[model samples]
Target: MLKNSMSVEFMAISDNERFARSVAAAFVIGLDPTMEEISEIKTAVSEAVTNAIIHGYNDTGRGRIVMEGTIYEDSVEFRISDEGVGISDIRRAREPLYTGKPEDERSGMGFTIMETFMDSVEVESEKNKGTSIIMTKTVKQVGK
Candidate 1:
Protein backbone atom coordinates (compact mmCIF):
# COMPACT_ATOMS: atom_id res chain seq x y z
CA MET A 1 0.00 0.00 0.00
CA LEU A 2 1.15 3.55 -0.65
CA LYS A 3 1.89 5.25 2.62
CA ASN A 4 3.19 8.60 1.49
CA SER A 5 3.28 10.68 -1.66
CA MET A 6 4.50 14.13 -2.73
CA SER A 7 5.27 16.14 -5.80
CA VAL A 8 7.54 19.12 -6.48
CA GLU A 9 8.13 21.33 -9.47
CA PHE A 10 11.23 23.40 -10.11
CA MET A 11 12.95 25.28 -12.87
CA ALA A 12 14.68 23.19 -15.46
CA ILE A 13 18.06 24.79 -14.80
CA SER A 14 21.44 23.18 -14.34
CA ASP A 15 21.56 24.08 -10.67
CA ASN A 16 18.14 22.56 -10.03
CA GLU A 17 19.34 19.14 -11.11
CA ARG A 18 21.13 18.81 -7.80
CA PHE A 19 18.01 19.86 -6.00
CA ALA A 20 16.06 17.18 -7.86
CA ARG A 21 18.54 14.53 -6.81
CA SER A 22 18.35 15.63 -3.21
CA VAL A 23 14.59 15.59 -3.34
CA ALA A 24 14.59 12.05 -4.68
CA ALA A 25 16.95 10.92 -1.97
CA ALA A 26 14.96 12.48 0.80
CA PHE A 27 11.68 11.10 -0.49
CA VAL A 28 12.84 7.49 -0.32
CA ILE A 29 14.81 7.71 2.90
CA GLY A 30 11.83 6.52 4.90
CA LEU A 31 12.20 3.09 3.30
CA ASP A 32 15.72 2.91 4.76
CA PRO A 33 17.21 2.04 1.41
CA THR A 34 20.75 0.84 1.23
CA MET A 35 23.48 3.30 0.37
CA GLU A 36 23.82 1.69 -3.04
CA GLU A 37 20.10 1.87 -3.63
CA ILE A 38 20.08 5.51 -2.61
CA SER A 39 22.96 6.25 -4.94
CA GLU A 40 21.24 4.48 -7.81
CA ILE A 41 18.04 6.45 -7.25
CA LYS A 42 19.98 9.71 -7.10
CA THR A 43 21.82 8.93 -10.32
CA ALA A 44 18.56 8.09 -12.07
CA VAL A 45 16.98 11.34 -10.87
CA SER A 46 20.01 13.29 -12.04
CA GLU A 47 19.81 11.74 -15.47
CA ALA A 48 16.10 12.35 -15.83
CA VAL A 49 16.38 15.93 -14.59
CA THR A 50 19.36 16.59 -16.84
CA ASN A 51 17.42 15.36 -19.87
CA ALA A 52 14.46 17.58 -19.01
CA ILE A 53 16.72 20.60 -18.79
CA ILE A 54 18.96 19.91 -21.75
CA HIS A 55 16.89 17.96 -24.24
CA GLY A 56 13.31 18.72 -23.29
CA TYR A 57 13.90 22.48 -23.14
CA ASN A 58 16.17 22.46 -26.20
CA ASP A 59 19.08 23.48 -24.04
CA THR A 60 17.29 26.78 -23.44
CA GLY A 61 17.57 26.22 -19.68
CA ARG A 62 14.12 27.70 -19.26
CA GLY A 63 11.23 25.44 -18.35
CA ARG A 64 9.66 23.51 -15.53
CA ILE A 65 10.53 20.06 -14.20
CA VAL A 66 8.00 18.23 -12.12
CA MET A 67 8.98 15.34 -9.88
CA GLU A 68 6.33 13.30 -8.13
CA GLY A 69 7.12 10.55 -5.67
CA THR A 70 5.03 7.87 -3.98
CA ILE A 71 6.29 5.69 -1.17
CA TYR A 72 4.90 2.18 -0.93
CA GLU A 73 5.40 -0.25 1.88
CA ASP A 74 8.60 -1.58 0.31
CA SER A 75 9.06 0.44 -2.82
CA VAL A 76 9.05 3.93 -4.25
CA GLU A 77 7.84 5.42 -7.51
CA PHE A 78 9.10 8.60 -9.18
CA ARG A 79 7.58 10.47 -12.04
CA ILE A 80 9.63 13.16 -13.78
CA SER A 81 7.93 15.40 -16.27
CA ASP A 82 8.69 18.40 -18.46
CA GLU A 83 6.66 20.75 -20.60
CA GLY A 84 9.07 20.99 -23.49
CA VAL A 85 9.89 19.29 -26.73
CA GLY A 86 8.97 15.68 -26.20
CA ILE A 87 11.05 12.73 -27.28
CA SER A 88 10.82 11.82 -30.92
CA ASP A 89 11.72 8.18 -30.46
CA ILE A 90 11.81 6.69 -26.98
CA ARG A 91 12.97 3.31 -28.27
CA ARG A 92 15.93 4.76 -30.16
CA ALA A 93 16.73 6.97 -27.21
CA ARG A 94 16.94 4.00 -24.87
CA GLU A 95 19.47 2.18 -27.00
CA PRO A 96 22.83 1.97 -25.32
CA LEU A 97 25.30 4.66 -26.38
CA TYR A 98 22.77 6.19 -28.79
CA THR A 99 23.08 9.85 -28.02
CA GLY A 100 21.06 12.29 -30.07
CA LYS A 101 23.42 15.13 -29.15
CA PRO A 102 26.82 13.70 -29.78
CA GLU A 103 28.06 17.17 -30.59
CA ASP A 104 27.33 18.14 -27.00
CA GLU A 105 29.29 15.11 -25.72
CA ARG A 106 26.16 13.53 -24.34
CA SER A 107 26.40 9.89 -23.33
CA GLY A 108 22.75 9.13 -24.23
CA MET A 109 22.50 6.66 -21.37
CA GLY A 110 19.71 8.36 -19.49
CA PHE A 111 17.00 5.80 -20.20
CA THR A 112 19.39 2.90 -20.00
CA ILE A 113 20.66 3.96 -16.62
CA MET A 114 17.16 4.55 -15.33
CA GLU A 115 16.06 1.11 -16.53
CA THR A 116 19.10 -0.56 -15.06
CA PHE A 117 18.64 0.82 -11.58
CA MET A 118 14.91 0.88 -11.37
CA ASP A 119 12.64 -2.14 -11.49
CA SER A 120 10.34 -0.46 -13.97
CA VAL A 121 10.36 2.56 -16.30
CA GLU A 122 7.67 3.92 -18.56
CA VAL A 123 7.82 6.97 -20.82
CA GLU A 124 4.93 8.88 -22.35
CA SER A 125 5.45 11.78 -24.72
CA GLU A 126 4.23 13.41 -27.88
CA LYS A 127 5.67 15.86 -30.35
CA ASN A 128 5.43 19.48 -29.18
CA LYS A 129 3.68 18.26 -26.07
CA GLY A 130 5.92 17.00 -23.26
CA THR A 131 7.46 13.91 -21.67
CA SER A 132 6.89 12.07 -18.46
CA ILE A 133 9.05 9.24 -17.16
CA ILE A 134 7.62 6.95 -14.52
CA MET A 135 10.18 4.90 -12.62
CA THR A 136 9.79 2.54 -9.69
CA LYS A 137 12.20 0.66 -7.48
CA THR A 138 11.57 -1.98 -4.84
CA VAL A 139 13.62 -2.29 -1.68
CA LYS A 140 13.90 -5.98 -1.02
CA GLN A 141 15.27 -5.44 2.46
CA VAL A 142 13.61 -2.66 4.38
CA GLY A 143 15.65 -1.26 7.23
CA LYS A 144 14.27 -1.02 10.72
Candidate 2:
Protein backbone atom coordinates (compact mmCIF):
# COMPACT_ATOMS: atom_id res chain seq x y z
CA MET A 1 0.00 0.00 0.00
CA LEU A 2 1.54 3.24 -1.10
CA LYS A 3 0.82 6.17 1.21
CA ASN A 4 1.88 9.80 1.01
CA SER A 5 0.56 13.23 1.79
CA MET A 6 1.23 16.92 1.28
CA SER A 7 -0.16 20.26 2.43
CA VAL A 8 0.28 23.80 1.17
CA GLU A 9 -1.10 27.23 1.95
CA PHE A 10 -1.25 30.24 -0.30
CA MET A 11 -3.05 33.49 -0.73
CA ALA A 12 -6.51 33.09 -2.25
CA ILE A 13 -6.13 34.73 -5.60
CA SER A 14 -7.13 33.96 -9.17
CA ASP A 15 -3.53 33.45 -10.23
CA ASN A 16 -3.11 30.70 -7.67
CA GLU A 17 -5.79 28.58 -9.25
CA ARG A 18 -3.35 27.22 -11.82
CA PHE A 19 -0.82 26.67 -9.09
CA ALA A 20 -3.37 24.68 -7.13
CA ARG A 21 -4.14 22.54 -10.16
CA SER A 22 -0.48 21.83 -10.77
CA VAL A 23 0.06 20.89 -7.15
CA ALA A 24 -2.84 18.47 -7.24
CA ALA A 25 -1.61 16.88 -10.43
CA ALA A 26 1.89 16.49 -9.03
CA PHE A 27 0.56 14.88 -5.87
CA VAL A 28 -1.25 12.20 -7.85
CA ILE A 29 1.37 11.56 -10.49
CA GLY A 30 3.00 8.89 -8.39
CA LEU A 31 -0.22 6.89 -8.48
CA ASP A 32 0.35 6.38 -12.24
CA PRO A 33 -2.91 8.08 -13.06
CA THR A 34 -4.11 8.07 -16.64
CA MET A 35 -4.30 11.22 -18.72
CA GLU A 36 -8.03 11.39 -18.17
CA GLU A 37 -7.51 11.03 -14.46
CA ILE A 38 -4.97 13.81 -14.51
CA SER A 39 -7.30 16.09 -16.40
CA GLU A 40 -10.18 15.35 -14.08
CA ILE A 41 -8.10 16.01 -11.01
CA LYS A 42 -6.77 19.26 -12.40
CA THR A 43 -10.23 20.44 -13.38
CA ALA A 44 -11.66 19.59 -9.98
CA VAL A 45 -8.81 21.35 -8.23
CA SER A 46 -9.30 24.40 -10.39
CA GLU A 47 -12.96 24.55 -9.46
CA ALA A 48 -12.35 24.13 -5.74
CA VAL A 49 -9.60 26.71 -5.65
CA THR A 50 -11.58 29.14 -7.74
CA ASN A 51 -14.52 28.79 -5.41
CA ALA A 52 -12.29 29.52 -2.45
CA ILE A 53 -10.94 32.62 -4.13
CA ILE A 54 -14.14 33.93 -5.66
CA HIS A 55 -16.99 32.84 -3.46
CA GLY A 56 -15.30 32.24 -0.15
CA TYR A 57 -13.05 35.26 -0.17
CA ASN A 58 -15.11 37.34 -2.56
CA ASP A 59 -12.03 37.88 -4.77
CA THR A 60 -10.51 40.05 -2.08
CA GLY A 61 -7.21 38.17 -2.45
CA ARG A 62 -6.61 38.58 1.26
CA GLY A 63 -7.37 35.17 2.71
CA ARG A 64 -5.45 31.97 3.02
CA ILE A 65 -6.35 28.86 1.07
CA VAL A 66 -5.01 25.62 2.38
CA MET A 67 -4.86 22.64 0.03
CA GLU A 68 -3.99 19.19 1.25
CA GLY A 69 -3.72 15.81 -0.43
CA THR A 70 -3.33 12.25 0.75
CA ILE A 71 -2.61 9.12 -1.19
CA TYR A 72 -3.83 5.69 -0.05
CA GLU A 73 -3.06 2.75 -2.30
CA ASP A 74 -4.72 3.62 -5.60
CA SER A 75 -6.90 6.37 -4.31
CA VAL A 76 -6.29 10.04 -3.61
CA GLU A 77 -8.14 12.54 -1.46
CA PHE A 78 -7.91 16.31 -1.50
CA ARG A 79 -9.14 18.90 0.93
CA ILE A 80 -9.30 22.58 -0.02
CA SER A 81 -10.12 25.06 2.68
CA ASP A 82 -10.39 28.81 3.07
CA GLU A 83 -10.90 31.09 6.03
CA GLY A 84 -13.35 33.41 4.38
CA VAL A 85 -17.04 34.14 4.37
CA GLY A 86 -18.70 30.76 4.37
CA ILE A 87 -21.70 29.48 2.58
CA SER A 88 -24.99 30.43 4.19
CA ASP A 89 -27.04 27.71 2.50
CA ILE A 90 -25.13 24.68 1.42
CA ARG A 91 -28.14 22.90 0.04
CA ARG A 92 -29.09 25.70 -2.30
CA ALA A 93 -25.48 26.27 -3.14
CA ARG A 94 -25.16 22.73 -4.43
CA GLU A 95 -28.21 23.02 -6.60
CA PRO A 96 -27.42 23.25 -10.30
CA LEU A 97 -27.34 26.67 -11.90
CA TYR A 98 -27.54 28.44 -8.56
CA THR A 99 -25.17 31.35 -8.20
CA GLY A 100 -24.79 33.39 -5.05
CA LYS A 101 -23.31 36.21 -7.10
CA PRO A 102 -25.52 36.39 -10.12
CA GLU A 103 -24.19 39.80 -10.96
CA ASP A 104 -20.83 38.26 -11.70
CA GLU A 105 -22.43 35.97 -14.29
CA ARG A 106 -21.28 33.02 -12.31
CA SER A 107 -22.52 29.74 -13.71
CA GLY A 108 -22.83 28.28 -10.21
CA MET A 109 -21.42 24.97 -11.43
CA GLY A 110 -18.38 24.78 -9.23
CA PHE A 111 -19.83 22.05 -7.07
CA THR A 112 -21.33 20.39 -10.08
CA ILE A 113 -17.98 20.21 -11.87
CA MET A 114 -16.26 18.87 -8.80
CA GLU A 115 -18.96 16.22 -8.38
CA THR A 116 -18.68 15.27 -12.01
CA PHE A 117 -14.90 14.87 -12.01
CA MET A 118 -14.36 13.26 -8.64
CA ASP A 119 -15.86 10.10 -7.23
CA SER A 120 -17.11 11.91 -4.15
CA VAL A 121 -17.20 15.49 -2.89
CA GLU A 122 -18.06 16.63 0.61
CA VAL A 123 -18.61 20.26 1.55
CA GLU A 124 -18.22 21.57 5.09
CA SER A 125 -19.00 25.18 5.84
CA GLU A 126 -20.17 27.62 8.46
CA LYS A 127 -22.12 30.81 7.96
CA ASN A 128 -19.28 33.11 8.99
CA LYS A 129 -16.34 30.84 9.67
CA GLY A 130 -15.19 29.33 6.36
CA THR A 131 -15.63 26.49 3.85
CA SER A 132 -13.85 23.26 3.10
CA ILE A 133 -14.31 20.94 0.15
CA ILE A 134 -13.24 17.36 0.55
CA MET A 135 -12.95 15.26 -2.57
CA THR A 136 -11.74 11.77 -3.40
CA LYS A 137 -10.91 9.81 -6.52
CA THR A 138 -9.84 6.25 -7.16
CA VAL A 139 -7.23 5.70 -9.83
CA LYS A 140 -8.49 2.96 -12.07
CA GLN A 141 -6.08 0.29 -13.16
CA VAL A 142 -6.16 0.42 -16.91
CA GLY A 143 -4.41 -2.89 -17.30
CA LYS A 144 -3.32 -5.64 -14.95
Candidate 3:
Protein backbone atom coordinates (compact mmCIF):
# COMPACT_ATOMS: atom_id res chain seq x y z
CA MET A 1 0.00 0.00 0.00
CA LEU A 2 1.25 3.43 -0.97
CA LYS A 3 -0.08 6.95 -0.73
CA ASN A 4 0.80 9.92 -2.88
CA SER A 5 -0.74 12.89 -4.60
CA MET A 6 -0.10 15.54 -7.25
CA SER A 7 -1.94 18.34 -8.96
CA VAL A 8 -1.32 20.31 -12.12
CA GLU A 9 -2.76 23.28 -13.96
CA PHE A 10 -2.65 23.84 -17.68
CA MET A 11 -4.33 25.68 -20.49
CA ALA A 12 -7.39 23.89 -21.77
CA ILE A 13 -5.89 23.20 -25.19
CA SER A 14 -6.49 20.05 -27.19
CA ASP A 15 -2.86 19.04 -27.31
CA ASN A 16 -2.46 19.09 -23.54
CA GLU A 17 -4.96 16.30 -23.21
CA ARG A 18 -2.20 13.77 -23.57
CA PHE A 19 -0.11 15.66 -21.06
CA ALA A 20 -2.89 15.41 -18.52
CA ARG A 21 -3.10 11.66 -18.96
CA SER A 22 0.63 11.28 -18.68
CA VAL A 23 0.72 13.23 -15.46
CA ALA A 24 -2.05 11.12 -14.01
CA ALA A 25 -0.33 7.88 -14.93
CA ALA A 26 2.92 9.12 -13.51
CA PHE A 27 1.34 10.14 -10.26
CA VAL A 28 0.34 6.54 -9.57
CA ILE A 29 3.83 5.20 -10.17
CA GLY A 30 4.30 4.51 -6.47
CA LEU A 31 1.57 1.91 -6.65
CA ASP A 32 3.17 0.11 -9.62
CA PRO A 33 -0.27 -0.40 -11.10
CA THR A 34 -0.87 -3.05 -13.69
CA MET A 35 -0.99 -2.10 -17.35
CA GLU A 36 -4.75 -2.50 -17.46
CA GLU A 37 -5.16 -0.30 -14.41
CA ILE A 38 -2.86 2.34 -15.83
CA SER A 39 -4.70 2.32 -19.13
CA GLU A 40 -8.02 2.79 -17.38
CA ILE A 41 -6.68 5.77 -15.50
CA LYS A 42 -5.22 7.29 -18.63
CA THR A 43 -8.38 6.82 -20.62
CA ALA A 44 -10.59 8.32 -17.92
CA VAL A 45 -8.26 11.26 -17.53
CA SER A 46 -8.24 11.80 -21.27
CA GLU A 47 -12.01 11.89 -21.43
CA ALA A 48 -12.25 14.31 -18.51
CA VAL A 49 -9.60 16.63 -19.89
CA THR A 50 -11.10 16.56 -23.34
CA ASN A 51 -14.47 17.52 -21.89
CA ALA A 52 -12.89 20.44 -20.10
CA ILE A 53 -11.30 21.60 -23.31
CA ILE A 54 -14.27 21.08 -25.54
CA HIS A 55 -17.60 21.43 -23.74
CA GLY A 56 -16.36 23.42 -20.77
CA TYR A 57 -14.37 25.95 -22.73
CA ASN A 58 -16.75 25.86 -25.67
CA ASP A 59 -13.79 25.07 -27.93
CA THR A 60 -12.38 28.51 -27.37
CA GLY A 61 -9.28 27.00 -25.69
CA ARG A 62 -8.92 29.94 -23.37
CA GLY A 63 -9.88 28.39 -20.07
CA ARG A 64 -7.91 26.81 -17.24
CA ILE A 65 -7.93 23.17 -16.25
CA VAL A 66 -6.83 21.73 -12.95
CA MET A 67 -6.19 18.01 -12.61
CA GLU A 68 -5.45 16.33 -9.31
CA GLY A 69 -4.69 12.73 -8.48
CA THR A 70 -4.31 10.98 -5.17
CA ILE A 71 -3.23 7.44 -4.45
CA TYR A 72 -4.67 5.61 -1.48
CA GLU A 73 -3.96 2.16 -0.12
CA ASP A 74 -5.61 0.38 -3.02
CA SER A 75 -7.41 3.03 -5.03
CA VAL A 76 -6.71 6.17 -6.96
CA GLU A 77 -8.90 9.25 -7.10
CA PHE A 78 -8.88 11.92 -9.78
CA ARG A 79 -10.53 15.27 -9.91
CA ILE A 80 -10.56 17.53 -12.94
CA SER A 81 -11.97 21.02 -12.74
CA ASP A 82 -12.53 23.86 -15.18
CA GLU A 83 -13.60 27.45 -14.82
CA GLY A 84 -15.48 27.72 -18.06
CA VAL A 85 -19.04 27.83 -19.20
CA GLY A 86 -20.64 25.35 -16.82
CA ILE A 87 -23.13 22.70 -17.72
CA SER A 88 -26.65 23.99 -17.49
CA ASP A 89 -28.08 20.55 -16.92
CA ILE A 90 -26.09 17.96 -14.99
CA ARG A 91 -28.58 15.13 -15.39
CA ARG A 92 -28.79 15.57 -19.12
CA ALA A 93 -25.05 15.76 -19.57
CA ARG A 94 -24.54 12.47 -17.75
CA GLU A 95 -26.88 10.69 -20.10
CA PRO A 96 -25.14 8.40 -22.53
CA LEU A 97 -24.83 9.65 -26.12
CA TYR A 98 -25.81 13.15 -25.16
CA THR A 99 -23.65 15.85 -26.62
CA GLY A 100 -24.34 19.54 -26.49
CA LYS A 101 -22.81 19.95 -29.93
CA PRO A 102 -23.84 17.38 -32.42
CA GLU A 103 -22.45 19.54 -35.19
CA ASP A 104 -18.91 18.73 -33.98
CA GLU A 105 -19.46 15.01 -34.47
CA ARG A 106 -18.90 14.21 -30.85
CA SER A 107 -20.04 10.81 -29.62
CA GLY A 108 -21.05 12.12 -26.18
CA MET A 109 -19.39 9.24 -24.35
CA GLY A 110 -17.10 11.10 -22.02
CA PHE A 111 -19.07 10.61 -18.84
CA THR A 112 -19.97 7.08 -19.79
CA ILE A 113 -16.38 6.10 -20.36
CA MET A 114 -15.31 7.68 -17.12
CA GLU A 115 -18.01 5.92 -15.17
CA THR A 116 -17.25 2.61 -16.84
CA PHE A 117 -13.53 2.78 -16.21
CA MET A 118 -13.71 4.17 -12.71
CA ASP A 119 -15.42 2.65 -9.72
CA SER A 120 -17.15 5.94 -9.01
CA VAL A 121 -17.79 9.19 -10.83
CA GLU A 122 -19.50 12.37 -9.65
CA VAL A 123 -20.17 15.67 -11.35
CA GLU A 124 -20.97 19.09 -9.85
CA SER A 125 -21.69 22.25 -11.74
CA GLU A 126 -23.85 25.32 -11.92
CA LYS A 127 -25.18 27.25 -14.87
CA ASN A 128 -22.31 29.72 -14.98
CA LYS A 129 -20.11 28.74 -12.05
CA GLY A 130 -17.81 26.00 -13.50
CA THR A 131 -17.68 22.25 -13.18
CA SER A 132 -15.76 19.48 -11.48
CA ILE A 133 -15.50 15.77 -12.18
CA ILE A 134 -14.32 13.37 -9.52
CA MET A 135 -13.55 9.75 -10.33
CA THR A 136 -12.05 6.90 -8.35
CA LYS A 137 -10.84 3.39 -9.20
CA THR A 138 -9.31 0.55 -7.28
CA VAL A 139 -5.90 -0.14 -8.71
CA LYS A 140 -5.38 -3.55 -7.21
CA GLN A 141 -7.50 -6.49 -8.25
CA VAL A 142 -8.74 -8.95 -5.68
CA GLY A 143 -6.54 -12.00 -5.05
CA LYS A 144 -3.95 -10.70 -7.43
Candidate 4:
Protein backbone atom coordinates (compact mmCIF):
# COMPACT_ATOMS: atom_id res chain seq x y z
CA MET A 1 0.00 0.00 0.00
CA LEU A 2 1.78 3.11 -1.28
CA LYS A 3 0.82 6.38 0.43
CA ASN A 4 -0.34 9.31 -1.63
CA SER A 5 -0.76 7.11 -4.68
CA MET A 6 -3.53 5.04 -6.12
CA SER A 7 -2.80 1.35 -5.75
CA VAL A 8 -4.38 -1.86 -6.95
CA GLU A 9 -3.64 -5.43 -5.91
CA PHE A 10 -4.73 -8.41 -7.93
CA MET A 11 -4.13 -12.12 -7.65
CA ALA A 12 -1.90 -13.69 -10.26
CA ILE A 13 -3.61 -16.26 -12.43
CA SER A 14 -3.34 -17.06 -16.13
CA ASP A 15 -6.99 -16.29 -16.67
CA ASN A 16 -6.66 -12.97 -14.81
CA GLU A 17 -3.97 -11.51 -17.05
CA ARG A 18 -6.39 -9.53 -19.19
CA PHE A 19 -8.27 -8.36 -16.13
CA ALA A 20 -5.06 -7.13 -14.57
CA ARG A 21 -4.15 -5.17 -17.69
CA SER A 22 -7.57 -3.64 -17.86
CA VAL A 23 -7.39 -2.59 -14.24
CA ALA A 24 -3.98 -1.05 -14.76
CA ALA A 25 -5.17 0.75 -17.86
CA ALA A 26 -8.12 2.17 -16.00
CA PHE A 27 -5.91 3.34 -13.17
CA VAL A 28 -3.51 5.09 -15.54
CA ILE A 29 -6.40 6.63 -17.39
CA GLY A 30 -7.62 8.16 -14.13
CA LEU A 31 -4.22 9.80 -13.87
CA ASP A 32 -4.77 11.39 -17.28
CA PRO A 33 -2.39 9.12 -19.16
CA THR A 34 -1.94 9.76 -22.83
CA MET A 35 -3.02 7.37 -25.53
CA GLU A 36 0.56 6.34 -26.24
CA GLU A 37 1.28 6.02 -22.55
CA ILE A 38 -1.73 3.83 -22.06
CA SER A 39 -0.66 1.54 -24.89
CA GLU A 40 2.87 1.21 -23.52
CA ILE A 41 1.66 0.63 -19.99
CA LYS A 42 -0.73 -2.06 -21.19
CA THR A 43 2.05 -3.78 -23.10
CA ALA A 44 4.38 -3.69 -20.12
CA VAL A 45 1.69 -5.06 -17.84
CA SER A 46 1.00 -7.86 -20.30
CA GLU A 47 4.66 -8.82 -20.45
CA ALA A 48 5.07 -8.85 -16.70
CA VAL A 49 1.92 -10.86 -16.12
CA THR A 50 2.82 -13.29 -18.88
CA ASN A 51 6.25 -13.81 -17.39
CA ALA A 52 4.71 -14.49 -14.00
CA ILE A 53 2.40 -17.06 -15.53
CA ILE A 54 4.84 -18.75 -17.92
CA HIS A 55 8.27 -18.48 -16.35
CA GLY A 56 7.40 -18.08 -12.71
CA TYR A 57 4.63 -20.62 -12.56
CA ASN A 58 5.97 -22.72 -15.46
CA ASP A 59 2.41 -22.71 -16.78
CA THR A 60 1.44 -25.12 -14.09
CA GLY A 61 -1.61 -22.97 -13.37
CA ARG A 62 -1.17 -23.57 -9.71
CA GLY A 63 0.48 -20.34 -8.55
CA ARG A 64 -0.55 -16.76 -8.07
CA ILE A 65 0.65 -13.39 -9.36
CA VAL A 66 0.21 -10.30 -7.20
CA MET A 67 0.13 -7.07 -9.15
CA GLU A 68 0.17 -3.58 -7.68
CA GLY A 69 0.15 -0.11 -9.21
CA THR A 70 1.22 3.14 -7.60
CA ILE A 71 0.50 6.49 -9.13
CA TYR A 72 2.93 9.16 -8.02
CA GLU A 73 3.01 12.87 -8.63
CA ASP A 74 5.45 12.60 -11.51
CA SER A 75 5.45 8.95 -12.33
CA VAL A 76 3.60 5.67 -12.11
CA GLU A 77 4.96 2.39 -10.77
CA PHE A 78 3.68 -1.10 -11.47
CA ARG A 79 4.81 -4.06 -9.41
CA ILE A 80 3.97 -7.60 -10.45
CA SER A 81 4.91 -10.46 -8.17
CA ASP A 82 4.54 -14.20 -8.17
CA GLU A 83 5.24 -17.13 -5.88
CA GLY A 84 6.43 -19.97 -8.03
CA VAL A 85 9.56 -21.76 -9.24
CA GLY A 86 11.41 -18.44 -9.41
CA ILE A 87 14.05 -17.45 -11.94
CA SER A 88 17.11 -19.68 -12.05
CA ASP A 89 18.98 -17.48 -14.49
CA ILE A 90 18.41 -13.75 -14.36
CA ARG A 91 21.08 -12.98 -16.92
CA ARG A 92 19.73 -15.41 -19.45
CA ALA A 93 16.19 -14.21 -18.86
CA ARG A 94 17.20 -10.63 -19.50
CA GLU A 95 18.98 -11.51 -22.69
CA PRO A 96 17.22 -10.60 -25.90
CA LEU A 97 15.77 -13.50 -27.90
CA TYR A 98 16.31 -15.92 -25.05
CA THR A 99 13.24 -17.98 -24.37
CA GLY A 100 13.14 -20.68 -21.75
CA LYS A 101 10.38 -22.37 -23.71
CA PRO A 102 11.25 -22.10 -27.33
CA GLU A 103 8.55 -24.48 -28.42
CA ASP A 104 5.83 -22.09 -27.22
CA GLU A 105 6.77 -19.31 -29.64
CA ARG A 106 7.51 -17.06 -26.71
CA SER A 107 10.00 -14.91 -28.64
CA GLY A 108 11.94 -14.28 -25.41
CA MET A 109 11.02 -10.62 -25.60
CA GLY A 110 9.19 -10.10 -22.32
CA PHE A 111 11.83 -8.12 -20.47
CA THR A 112 12.94 -6.38 -23.64
CA ILE A 113 9.45 -5.15 -24.30
CA MET A 114 9.03 -4.04 -20.70
CA GLU A 115 12.29 -2.07 -20.77
CA THR A 116 11.38 -0.37 -24.01
CA PHE A 117 7.92 0.55 -22.77
CA MET A 118 8.56 1.79 -19.26
CA ASP A 119 11.07 4.37 -18.06
CA SER A 120 12.64 1.87 -15.68
CA VAL A 121 12.19 -1.81 -14.91
CA GLU A 122 13.65 -3.79 -12.02
CA VAL A 123 13.39 -7.49 -11.23
CA GLU A 124 13.92 -9.31 -7.94
CA SER A 125 13.60 -13.03 -7.46
CA GLU A 126 14.85 -15.94 -5.39
CA LYS A 127 15.08 -19.60 -6.26
CA ASN A 128 12.22 -20.54 -3.96
CA LYS A 129 10.98 -17.26 -2.60
CA GLY A 130 9.37 -15.66 -5.65
CA THR A 131 9.81 -13.05 -8.40
CA SER A 132 8.87 -9.38 -8.55
CA ILE A 133 8.97 -6.82 -11.35
CA ILE A 134 8.96 -3.10 -10.55
CA MET A 135 8.24 -0.99 -13.60
CA THR A 136 8.12 2.80 -13.55
CA LYS A 137 7.17 5.40 -16.11
CA THR A 138 7.50 9.18 -15.72
CA VAL A 139 4.49 11.09 -16.86
CA LYS A 140 5.00 14.01 -19.23
CA GLN A 141 3.07 17.11 -18.37
CA VAL A 142 0.91 18.58 -21.07
CA GLY A 143 1.57 22.28 -20.40
CA LYS A 144 4.95 22.50 -18.83
The TM-score values for the models, in the order shown, are: 0.97, 0.96, 0.94, 0.90
> Lowest-lDDT window of 10 residues in candidate 2?
135-144
lDDT of 4: 0.84
Least accurate 10 contiguous residues by lDDT in model 4: 1-10
Candidate 2 lDDT by residue in tens digits, 1-144 = 549999999999899999999999999988889999999999999999999999999999999999999999889999999988999999999998999999999999988999999999999998779999999999985643
- Runs off by more than 4 Å, candidate 3: 141-144
Error at 139, model 4, angstroms: 1.3
Better of 1 and 2 by TM-score: 1
- lDDT for each candidate structure: 0.91, 0.93, 0.89, 0.84
lDDT (Cα, tens digit) per residue for candidate 4, span 1-144: 343445455555667788888888888765677788888999999999999888888887777777778877767899999887788899889999999999999999999999999999999999988899999998674534
RMSD of each: 0.9, 1.2, 1.9, 2.2
Of candidates 4 and 1, the better by TM-score: 1
Rank by lDDT, highest first.
2, 1, 3, 4
Residue 26, candidate 3: alpha-carbon lDDT: 88
lDDT of 4 at 112: 97
> Model 3: per-residue lDDT, tens digit, 45-109?
99999998999899897989999888888888999999988898888998999999999999999
Off by over 4 Å in 4: 1-12
lDDT of 4 at 85: 78
Q: Backbone clashes per model, in order?
A: 0, 0, 0, 1
Which structure among the candidates has the greatest TM-score? Answer: 1
Lowest summed lDDT window (length 10), candidate 3? 135-144
lDDT of 3 at 121: 95
Top model number, lDDT:
2
